[model samples]
Target: MENAEPFHDTRGFFDKIGSRIGSQAPAVAHHINPTDALLLLQNYEESEQGWFWSTDAAGNLTYITEAIASVLGGGSRALLGKSMVSLFHKTAEGDAGSRTLPFILTKKMKFNSLEVKAAASQDECWLSISGRPHHDRSGNFLGFRGSGIDVTAQRRLSLDTARLAMFDSLTGLANRASMAKKLETTLTAYRQQKRTCAVMLVDLDRFKQINDTLGHPAGDALLKQVAERLLKVVGQGGEVCRLGGDEFQIMLPDCDDRGILGDLASKIIGSLSQPYSVEGNRCIIGASVGMAISPFDGLTSEDLVKSADLALYEAKGNGRGRFRFYSKDMQQSAEDRRLLEEDLRDAIAQGALELAYQPIVNAKSNIVEGFEALVRWNHPERGHISPGLFIPIAEDANLIWELGEWAIRQACADAAKWPGKARVAVNVSPIQFANDLFPGVIDAALGASGLASERLELEITEGVFMAETNETNAMFQALKGRNVRLALDDFGTGYSSLSYLQTAPFDKIKIDQSFVRGATEPGSRNGAIITAIVALAEALGMDTTAEGIETLDEFELIRNLQVSHVQGFVYSKAVSQQVLLENLEDGQWKIEPSGPAHHRNDRLSMYRKVRMIHENHVYSIVIRNLSVTGALIDGLYDVPVGTKFVIDFGEGQLALATVTRSNGSLQGIQFETRLVSDGNGGLCTSRRVSPYLIAEAGLDVPNLPAGYVPTTKIERDSLSLPAFSTVADWTPTKARPK
Candidate 1:
């Protein structure tokens, strides 16, 4: 190596340092020279702290100081002739610019202070490698010489810092910022390809209960299990991230099919809702999923995520443990929720809450054995309010206890007014049941009403026993001690634990309606569940009530299974206190049951209009009936059966259907995935056309119920155009064999 004009004054610097050292010590055997100084510097490079290394023209290590080779667990020649890049690499695999020793060597420029991962020692090693290019006098390329220092501890600290910034500390999943960046990247890339992606925003239901009941540590553990289950369900095709607290986001790439998305969402909900075993205690919870798709629901990440959030709000509000897709007309505004909450507080305070009674009929006698009291709210000015709407808010706002107390008292009082020896049943929330004062509240309600405890029933769900199992059992025993019948409501619907049934003081088991709804259908597994539950109830010496029996088929099935009681629309719609009183005054509790002889296979009568697209042509039709699997429609001109048509139910809702049966203008068409509950006594397709797309299509913002309407005018496609090649002078009877 040469310097410009003159070489560095190495000899003078050595001589000055040597004389100063000699004058101080005066006992040196020999004077130190530049040669000795160079030797000492070389020796220092061979120590454990630092090392010198060189690479050949081909980027293979020619020589590495003995210290580095020893640190790498070998003699001096072990790593010799190995690719220099093999010794160290970039901390992150995809990081660019000098990712490894070879990559930097390719630049062939003097470089310094490049950090690379080197796992040469027992602990992790990061090498700060510096290098200068060397060549012969003829300018022929030779190689590179560099020095490396151990920076293991510092590098690990930097990595830990980066991890804290990107990963959730509690759950070890991607944090909010990391999730946002990943979503942004995926959306941007997918948008370019015109491919679709789906994002599901999940909020764990009743997560706060864990924090309140157990502790934050247990909650943290539950969160970890939740992450693991999500990872198991999502697999490698999607990314699951914890966006803080109980909210998690799962991103599915290249997926836009709503049927698949809905199934996946349902799976996630089911998986997450299973009872969590935390520190030997069972904790039951649920999740609500809100899904939105890209380039359809949104073109940007923010818009898509916001759409998902809105859908999630609807899911939670409608009732937790369900999934909802983004829709333009969904009204889950915070102001509306808050306003309802405020009104709910006032309504309960004002005694505006009322109870509606639905009789629980004995399967054998078809007589009213007990009446289940359902709470209803009439907002004075707002008319009748649905419990589905207000009950969740009450739970969220901590007003459920007040509502529960009123319902209990009102139920008991109404039962006291009845002439017959009928019992009254009231549903209890887990929150209310968890309180130590629940037994006192029940006694007070019964006392205030002057009703016999034997004539009243307290219904509790399975969740009541999941946490504080022993305490819940104590509560159960105390309630039963009051001579009030304790019925387990919605049994086998959620996280059902047989242990609870074996131990808790339950007088009866109310089979959840989900199993009863389709039990009579051919080959339905619900029948098996119903029968099993009935057998279990009988074995445990508890009565069984099948709820939600809307048809005679369900009633007969319950009778065949020897279920004790039936409560559903088939018996009676919940009636006000006065209506119930008038019925009771007739002196008999017997009411004949009548409904459809058999299950409808989920088909329902409907009268609606929708557009049917056949071969790019739109036809207007009126749906005479609808079901999850298919629909019957009228209004089309001699359309052939077996023709595939896209059914447009407006607001971007589209379903592919085939005309399976056609007689005159009436036709039967089938859908893809069965329609799920829209949470409002309605059914809707999972995916909808975005409002942005509608605007781009130059159409008005429309609601879901409205059938497809063209931007200009809603009309059928004209059929006057020549649909195929036509001869200029061809006749029907012309000779064609020429």
Candidate 2:
């Protein structure tokens, strides 16, 4: 470009190039005129739609058409000898891919429609280049001659398409495809390296309620907020992705320690479940996480994902806002779940479900101030099923509304039969609170039962206050207008525990049971928490109830905190309707504080029926309380101190024991072996008669048979039974009449 004369037109450029070439190769191209060929080639190079370029064997530009030079925005001489690779550099590779334009060119491969960017240009310009290797007649490589077109607009479009394929449109998180590919790659590599990876599948609880109430646009905003929080939590070590709707998947590589994984899951749940402010409206939701680890829970992507999903279902099934791990035994059969659902539906419809009232007593006078109505289901065949197991089922099957309506009607009717001063409290689920017909349901129940609204208290968790929408506000106002009291239940378990106190209309705050159980242990913060809760309640002019008060120390600490009411075994367990009414009629509803002065390890206040065996005689007894080390028993009259016996905690949990203290009908026995978790929130002995052993003994069923005979010889003959002093009777001082 520097040495050649400028071409006035295509004809001049052709004649100049033709005359020079003809001088060097007059015999080579005698068949055609070089001047005519140069004219046609120059004409082709001058088109605006395309540009022509050529580089020597070293890949530096030897020539570029004048039109491309103008597009590059410089004189033709400046770009003629620059490196072609330096001018239009290839960009970073696409996601998870290895092929790049630079690499392709280095291989000397012919390529078409390859995209490159103008690295030296000031403007962001993309180009599509097509090139092929050139060779002289001697077959020695000369350089590359290529044609390129400006693909700036087309490049943007292609990039946008790639982004959409990899990212969620709503939250801008990695889409399912991206997550799947990453998980597969991670698992495959980690398996060979023996490194661990954890997968957590998070499903938002009560998300549908928000979606239906606030509409989809608000839901989208809420999701974006959730995504932002997750990104903050996950940070650098892992990836967070949206798996459509309100479900999310998190991939953590090189992490399999369940403690750390559990902590992360808990943090995610807490963060995501916090109240969301979307479009100026407050929305609340919760998350349940299920986690699985590679090389243990599963080995492949599909298996691991399925395991995590199952764990998530269990977490939600156990209770919302919880996390569960994948265990081998968690493979629940579909038929069993179906049968359970059908039975639950039948139980609700046929009045097999009943409510038990646990008294909330005034701390000073121990008078029955209120009763928390807890639902129970007697499966008739499976015996008494726990509310923990059934409540979640009712929620999942959309049977909560029906069960809730029944609870209200039944509670009101039962409350009518109680003393006029006694009040009844019932729990309200998020669905029940959000339903438009809930107010009418309450009104009808109150009217039909002739129960005063003042005697009915509705207990709600902080989660119900998540939505500050107009409709949600109206519902609250409507309930308050009925003159019924509102109690904030499980107060300190949620995020923003203090925020709800400012706006939520609550007459009472129930300190969550989790905080009450360990208030006495060394360095336990729960005692201080109780004190703070009581002080806050006083400031807000609201009463506070300390729940799960099982020991004398807990009660004293709670009373010191100035908690107004106490609801737990230290007062009274939920009793039958007949028991409640009889006590009310007899004027014996007042309970006196009675339990161990100091909390012991692994104590549980379980009132259940068990068997006491002494000297080969089996006697039925009532276990008033139990612990890992011992139990307080009744129904055995005048049992002597140090009497050797076997305490038969049901399900073949036989504990070898010696009575340490005997007082009237009650005796304290210490177990020789500690109990272990039954995997269902209860405890059992370390060993049990296996079902196979039961059948081998010719039992009628695979259970401890009545009038049983032990095949193993008794060892009590050689053991020493300690003779200890009789301890003083420890019933409630008031009930004992001094």
Candidate 3:
């Protein structure tokens, strides 16, 4: 080892040994002769791309070549034999004086490249360091040697990537992935220790609408503002992460008290409910929060997330701006609703639907003037389901048009079977009205049934006309030209009813059942309204119908108000066509009179009687019966068919009844009262007639006047005396005052 020509070409010895050991130990075998090793190491150390260094057994930096020192901003001579600890300024406690020393002692550690901040310039630097324990030929551990290469830019890029991976660019909070990872770890730990945790799913309501109406920049600003607000409100136990697009997920760990979850939820609601000023516009966005607690609402991450999501949907459904907790019943309800939706779609395709007719009767006459066709679903297993249950589902699924078409067709077909005078009222959903094909559907249904359009009445709520534009008006006008009667159903319920009634094209208005049900109560506002509506309809020349007339009182009240029609369970629940036909055939039809009837022993009596007097003699009498055909008195009134008679009573009691002798209106009149007062202190109501004979006599009044105007004294006196009177002197008849 004397300075013997410093064996520069020691590469041959390393090659020979490397050849014997194969390629694995080539680096170690290359440095064989101590002088040659020093020369080669010096050459490597002086190279710009490669730097060499050695660490002693005590983990001190014993040697540094000039090339390594230059890259680190110093000459090799200054760093040579200097302890590595002298280069590093320790900022954190417990950091080893030089991190490289641990690697040297733990020669089991290996590295292709590593990054470090250089102590010389205090600048971040990267190095490719590979080392093993230096040993003699006997394999005794001596020291460590490694090479270094600057990679400061690459190290900085790596740190940046790590930061970007965990943080959101806009809000600077943890992104979904990072938050999820943290949440999972926290949840797992909490579960292991039997502690509590909460997962909250927050959805900003109508945010899309806001984004659409405003601009995206405004939306972004609003989002940033929301993130800031959430950050401020999250408090100590929780962290908030934007899941994306108006949605955020919060994880509250170490929150042992479930009550605190509710409190936090309330705080969030209150905080978000406050108006936010964004881009010079005050934006108000409501938030719906659904929360799930660990080991209570759910145990696993998936379960918790799903439960919270379901609850969030529920909160949104309940008009938003609130929070809801996960519950078993809610889950079951959701499942059932899903099943119902599926079943409803299938039901429509299977044609398992039918229409039932509820008779709309004359409020005064109690005659079934028309029928309102109500849809019914006959599910194979579920029996009959009301429209209240499935109609909403159909509407939600956008299947209302198809279902509405079917209903219209069925209703029109049923109306075709009814008498020509009977009209069929079919409900039109708002969705159907919005559909462009609604008019075509109506025409097709009417054509398919061979029913006249006049016999079809389309009933819609006032809401249908809420957006009253030219298009809606045009559609309504077209329908009107087709002779389809447009009826305002459930009138007076909507806020725009008055405006709609005045503007929309409608032939009839049906007072809502709610009003009709309460019509008979004393001082009931509904009763007063019903009376006014009936009067208004009469004045406007439009028909009015009262719905939900289930009691006699309701019926009487409506009739007294002079409403044209009534429909409810009192007359009949919506029944099948066959039942209706059977009832019609059984001659069980009864038309209630317009006025209240006095009842004795459960039988209608004390009828309001109308009689005709001709030439100062009783010509005939027509009594308004309560439960039977209106009666007609025959004073040998063997009147021919279509004979119009002036029914006169001196005291404003006069009605005209055309005698249809063959069809026999007189036969239908049955007198239950024996002594009906003549209203002038005389009780003369004796009319004994054979039922068969009465049935044969046609007393039909073809031109029956609705009511008679008062007769002038001049007209009454103009009646001539009988032409066949004898020559005997006739005495003038005089009335005796009672």
Candidate 4:
């Protein structure tokens, strides 16, 4: 620092300081001299309140204070010859009360608190600088004289505060407010570019169970792990966010293909449903996804989010661990579900539910060994609703315990009146098994109905063992103490652990219907899986029952595999108690296995009204039986084989088919493209006609409940003649047609 040339001589520096202080002081302070002023300035430098510097007319540093020189290292010699702009740069791009130091110096202007950073420092170093252009006595520009103070700590604190406002502290993902802002901004910009975007809403299932059982700290750890997995699947493809408390949202830009979206949703569900290790405890949870596409679903952010939320509600309602795409009818479906929840509560109060028993028969002798009790609901207006529809509804509404307890007592009373030694199996839900008082419910039901405990079997799935805590083991022991039988239901479908089988006192292992239904297919591993399960059951002294045996081939394969029992439509569907009593009036009821000789495509029978278009002529048709590959229709008469028609299922779904068979008013048609699963045990088209295209075709898209027709426009004229006669009086039978 001493080798550098000073900008001011000692005499001139003292003279300037004395003149400034004398002008500002009163007459009594005139005794202050240049030597006194120079000593005072030296004292100020030693205090280290701030630093001072000067540059020549060419912007080369000429003088620097000792404190500033030492902080910059290499003393004053290294810094004196360096350009002022090269030594420091603007601290950041944007800030209040700040300007570029280079701009201020180039313009020869006075500035206050211009923040700059050291260009050569390894660590972050900030300085708030104030400077003025100094000129010679002739008014010629000489150089810049400046003062600076360290402000690095204040800058860092401000940056940290800004980050906290936009991110979640626990998971380190974008918060709700940040996500909302991003969605709004993106949509506003993309609307002008004619682009597409998609949104997915993911909700974690059974998270509360883990949270309540293990503790909050473990739950937090599990959430962090979930965030990591989501990032793995959606890397650089979209923005994944935490919407607080087990819910997450993802924004995918420039994607509108339903096939691609569905694949992503499935991947997310599978990844999240895997087991997590939290604090040395294994935890299992599931995820449900709902997706919505751009202009097709909605144009605005609010509408898109609402559509995604409705789809999420539908996905959860159908059953957790699945994904669903938004359709126009979902709004109505959600409202209907809300109404049905109320009706279910009333049904429980009025005792309007009843039990139907499906017999589980011996594979060799064909004699009934037991019956699994299934609940049936007959709504006054809707008629026989499927159990798949209402069971999930009951669970979500907190009505499962009430409905399940009623089922146990009702099954016991019904089984007591039977005239045989046949057992009755009742399904025990995970919610019921978790309650400590559930064993007492079982004991009371057996005592009140006077049914032997040995005749009542509780069917439990793998979900009850998710936690593997003492409570689960204690519940199993308590049931066993009552001399009741326990059957592991839906085996090989979930976490099939051989370790649990050894500890759990299970009397039987019921093979899941999924494996049985496909075991007879060509080149299927299900057959080998079934064989291994049977061998394992035999070794463990547990009886095995194969479920869903609907064909002779399946039944024969199961029998040859040495399965102890069989339960499915091959013997019979669930029958009412009165019918069961009539069959069991004589001791030892036996039946022969009678069903289709070969397995064919499983079709669902319905009387739904649809549209069939042939050569621009639209005709109303009623679907008799529907399957993924084809359907039977009753409307057009005398339609010859090989006639092509487009069938319109409502809500933008369309299928192209050709008539394969014709018999009177019935015509069987085969679809050109196979349908996909709708995630609710139903078939739907893989893609739908967008509403944007429908609007361009001169139709009110919002008011119509159907899709577009690609054929020439229909024009009613006097010369037009119908190709096929219409059957106006045809009606289906009261029973579902075969």
Q: By the TM-score metric, which is better: model 1 or model 3? A: 1
Candidate 2 lDDT, tens digit per residue, 602-640? 657777888776654566778888777888887765667
The TM-scores of all predictions, comma-separated, are: 0.81, 0.75, 0.42, 0.87
Candidate 1, which segments miss by more than 4 Å at Cα? 1-48, 52-66, 75-110, 116-124, 131-146, 331-336, 603-625, 630-647, 656-681, 686-738
Best-fitting candidate, measured by TM-score? 4
Residue 379, model 2: Cα distance from true site in angstroms:
0.8
Q: Judged by lDDT against the true structure, how good is candidate 2?
A: 0.78
Q: Which stretches of candidate 2 lie above 4 Å from their native place?
A: 1-48, 54-63, 70-73, 90-115, 130-146, 193-195, 333-335, 497-500, 586-588, 601-738
Candidate 4 has its poorest 10 consecutive residues by lDDT at 729-738
Per-residue accuracy of model 1 over 54-171 as CA lDDT, tens digit each = 7777787666777677676565567777777866644576755446556568868888888776655676666788999878678866788778887878877888999999999888
Worst 10 residues of 1 by lDDT: 1-10
By lDDT, who's the top model here? 4
Of candidates 4 and 2, the better by TM-score: 4
What is the C-alpha lDDT profile of model 4 across 1-738, one tens digit per residue? 112345443344445557767675666744666567777776676677777777887788877666766666557666776788887654555654444566678889998887777766678787777888888667888888877887888989888888778888889999888998999889878766757789999999889999998899999999999999999999999999999999999999988766677778888988887778899887778899988877667778888988999889999998778888888889999989998899999999999999999999999999998999999999999998777778889999999999999999999999999987899999999999999989999998999999999999999988787667888899999999999999999997675778889999999999998898768889999889999999999999999999989999999999999999999999999999999999999957798999998887879899989999777477899999989899999987778899999998976677899999999889999999887766556677777665555566444556322453333432467324557767874445322111
* Alpha-carbon runs more than 4 Å astray in model 4: 1-52, 63-77, 88-101, 703-722, 729-738
- Please provide the root mean square deviation of candidate 4 (C-alpha atoms, Å): 5.2
* Model 1, total clashes: 1
